[model samples]
Target: MVSRGYKKRGVGVMGLRHVKNPILLARAMLEHGEDDLEANPRGVNSGDLDVPSAQGHTQLYGKAAEQLAQQYELELVDPSYFFTQRRWDEHVRALEREKKGQGQATWSATEYLPQGTCGAVALDQDGVICAATSTGGLTNKLTGRIGDTPAIGSGFWAEEWAEDGDPTGSSTWDR
Candidate 1:
């Protein structure tokens, strides 16, 4: 699912499971610069190109997720978005507060999942699956930083329902 927020940003989610290593998918993004602007810009680069500096902080988590998948041989999935750091920070803080038993709060969808956002979610035939996602994260991210990508569960997850005849289990990361 790709979510975009008005005057804010957008996000995407990709999910997978029951495979060899789910984390590997996340890790691969880092090794190959899945979201590096220098390596994967949206437009042609000219000598006088005035494009803003692109951010790849989310790739950190994508790599981490890939590593976990490789080590555990589990399926992996990820959701990504192009959102502002402030909005990402808000989601992070909200998740943290929720962990502390705080009541649920409504977030501004327009500021989180805006239009023009795109992503993918993949599932295996037997219900096992893997997913990957990418985005520019907060149009103007800081010079040196990271986001929820490295935070497991928050960025990706492997879920199994009773219909699958397996005990409900999941792997997640939080930061």
Candidate 2:
């Protein structure tokens, strides 16, 4: 979303959507919230969110994201959009290791994997601050394993504060 010349929202991922570029998804959400704020000024409501299935160990968000994309008139791609042979093989190997009581091996591999959690922070010319992150939890994680990547504040955050009525100025410090 950074290269798109827009920076106004924060987002994080946790094995959901499986999109190759999660920034696009985060951008969409930011736009969605912007629209809501424009209309209500108070921000979006819970119902406005594209919540995923409340019950599901596998946590397939592709369908959910697709639905949201359709609603927002955004482009949608096939499952292969985020598919890769290396990732698939790694997932399979991790699963095998997990079944063989080698969960640590799977964790270690994920720790070093190049495709793990990602995050970004940006400040636009207009002073807009945006932060975002995305990740497909450790490869072959347990069925119910849910990481903090998808949770706001836990994975990423963006804040704006002014000191002495001047945002660009330094504030008085207290011990």
lDDT of 2 at 7: 34
Residues 1-175 of candidate 1 have per-residue lDDT tens digits of 1211211222222333232332344333333332435432434645433322223333222333343344434453333332356666766765665557665543545545442233355565765444444433443334444456533456544444444333445423221
| lDDT of each candidate versus the true structure | 0.39, 0.53
What's model 1's lDDT at 114?
A: 45
* Best model per TM-score: 2
How far residue 47's Cα lies from its native spot in candidate 2, in Å, is 16
RMSD (Cα, Å) for all candidates, in order, is 16.9, 8.3
Off by over 4 Å in 2: 1-20, 34-62, 102-112, 165-175
